[model samples]
Target: MDCDVLVVGAGAVGAVAALGLRRQGYRVRVLDAGQPMEAPTGEAIDPRVFALSPASIELLESLDLWPRLAPRAQGYAGMTVWDAVSGSDIRFRAAEFGLDGLGAIVENAALVSAAQAALDDVEFGAALAAVDETTDAVTVTTDDGRPVRARTLLLADGANSPGRQALGIAVSGRGYGGRAIVCHLRSERGHDVTAWQRFLPSGPVALLPLFDGRVSLVWSADDALADRLLALDDAAFSDAVTEATAGRLGALHTPTRRFAFPLRRQTAERFTTRRCVLLGDAAHVVHPLAGQGVNLGFDDLRALLVAMPDPDVGLRAAALRRYERARRADIAQMSQGIDGLDRLFSTANPAVSTVRGFGLHLADVVTPLKRRFAEVALGVKPGFPSASG
Candidate 1:
């Protein structure tokens, strides 16, 4: 085999995967169709950011990548979620859980840069064209007709993964018929280092605190509303956001460019074949209502690493099966929970809204229940009983 493992995609997850495997003394080859993202410069922040759980932070620290990301990461100590229609709210504090913060918000480009910097050999502009798997090794043919072979294949190519398609893996789920608009805005008041989210009938709008006074906004809305919001001028759009969030952070202004992507809930029929395993968005896509998308991907990587501590046995079918079994339940539970919340909040029914509001209220006051939710968010607890099977 050309290498111990061939990673097809150098996004945050893929690059980090390569870094982790290389640290374990494995010969790993990484391929990506695009060049590495340039590190963010100046005062501007990349609109694409992730809320990294403690578990994810631990993984990055273990791989010696956290030092690079820590400078730019912004930690949030509390989170407040509320219902716009029913005026119900729930708050979570890291202090309540005996932690400094729930999670840190890190820009995507920064993470990619850090991971890429830690790894010496990531072949950019190389795309996977074909895959030939056998009993012992998996070989990939690049679009340029270059052949790359490995003991096993790791597909982190993303939700629309060509690697997954090449393996004839099928993903099943429907789009939410909505899009999430993300950008940075300067709020009049400080965010108090709190992550704020309000569920409108259309969707959920989140304002995550940044190191700077500005907040990162992720507003998930239905198609029509999304189009309308995107069509508005900067002032009007910012005003709409202020209204949607009920002026929680005061009048928002100085908005950055807005970008939106369609929402979907997808899961691969299977996470592993005989010699190849899928990771990150390649295996599952969840709604962004909970800001757990990238974190789930990190969780996937951590589980795979734990299952495959030694490359000698890690490439075997049994180890791959162990990784798959450990992750599927957590991913499914998170996907279903986020999808359910999206559906629940998207409804305009008076009765259902009232009930959900009451549920949120109850969850807020119930210490044990709230603690459990916090544990899941922190990634300290898995959605299933055995996250490490």
Candidate 2:
């Protein structure tokens, strides 16, 4: 098999797909733009972090990638959500969901490295130049000059996937007028092995507990404020963080590595095109309010492998219709949910606050409903998977 599955973008999603696909008895090849030119491979830690769903953990565990990630990753028992203005709060625990841990707070670099190291088959440093879907198969070319054909092409190149565009997939994007400013901060108080998200008018400020006495923070704010915060000195930064989060984590001090990215709601017009399928960020990118972006990608990885044929497409129509149909509701629901949350807490009006706070209060008082909510938010509950129906 020259190429059983060709994956574009060797990021965490692409690496995981390559490993999982190869292990499922499919030959796989991966291509990346060679971040080595801009970022040293030795110190290649993606500043962004991810919250691995429990199902995602199971998949990683089965693939033997979890153990490799465990050393560099930190596990959280639960998360707390609050309002920066009104202080309306809701807490979800692993125990409430009948799980040992709510989820894992993993550095993006750690997951990428674990995913990469777990794969023995991949072609890094090769950015994709072209993707053509023929009558029978898909052909891919790389910048460093490597061409391969696979019966099925997996587009994991991320939100700005050029391969997706080259294949003429109409990707529509909508922005929330916000940016995610991320950095780590040393804490005086224990994050108590817990994750925290406070919804403010600017955006959300999440404090995910890390190894040692520190936490990784992603402060999504209006674009202008995010730019100014990124430029603040260490003392000013910490002071702002303390005030914004209501000093819950306590005595915050900004750690090294500060960065920001535009926030948006974008999805491809078609998730699958003939022999080509888009997965991971290539398919959709939503607000990081839920932190389910990569977990959603992992779900795709699992479903695609489960839906693959005995060998390859091999005159088969790829069964991608089944994949698309099975996954659409879940994707649509989540996209809308995130958009609603973005709007809910982003307005500065008092009427909006009162209504939203009352809703949160009602949710807090409702026991069974709250448990169900925890199950979904913490990624413990079995979701509507592409293979479920």
Best by TM-score: 1
lDDT of 2 by residue, 1-389 (tens): 35767778878788888887777677677777755212213333456878887878878887888887786667887788888666798887677556677778877777786677666545667788888788678888877667788877888889989889899889777887878888878887989988898999888889887765578888888879988898889899988988888899788985667888888889888888888888989998888888888988887877776777445442255577777775778778777777777788887789889887887787688877665555445545623222232
Q: Write the per-residue lDDT of candidate 1 for residues 1-389, one digit (tens) a residue.
A: 79998999999999999988887778899999999778887677999999887677778888889998888899887889889889999898776766666788999999999898788678999999999999888999999999999988999999999999999999999998999999999999899989999999989999998877789999999899999999999999999999999999999998999999989989999999888999999999888878887888988898888878877778777888999999989888877767777777877799999998898899898977776556544454423223241
Give the poorly placed runs of model 1, Cα more than 4 Å off.
375-389
Please report, in order, the local distance difference test score of every candidate based on alpha carbons. 0.87, 0.77
For model 2, give the 10-residue run with minimal summed lDDT: 36-45
Q: Per model, how many backbone clashes are there?
A: 0, 0
Clashing pairs in 1: none
TM-score of candidate 2 versus the correct structure, residues matched by position: 0.92
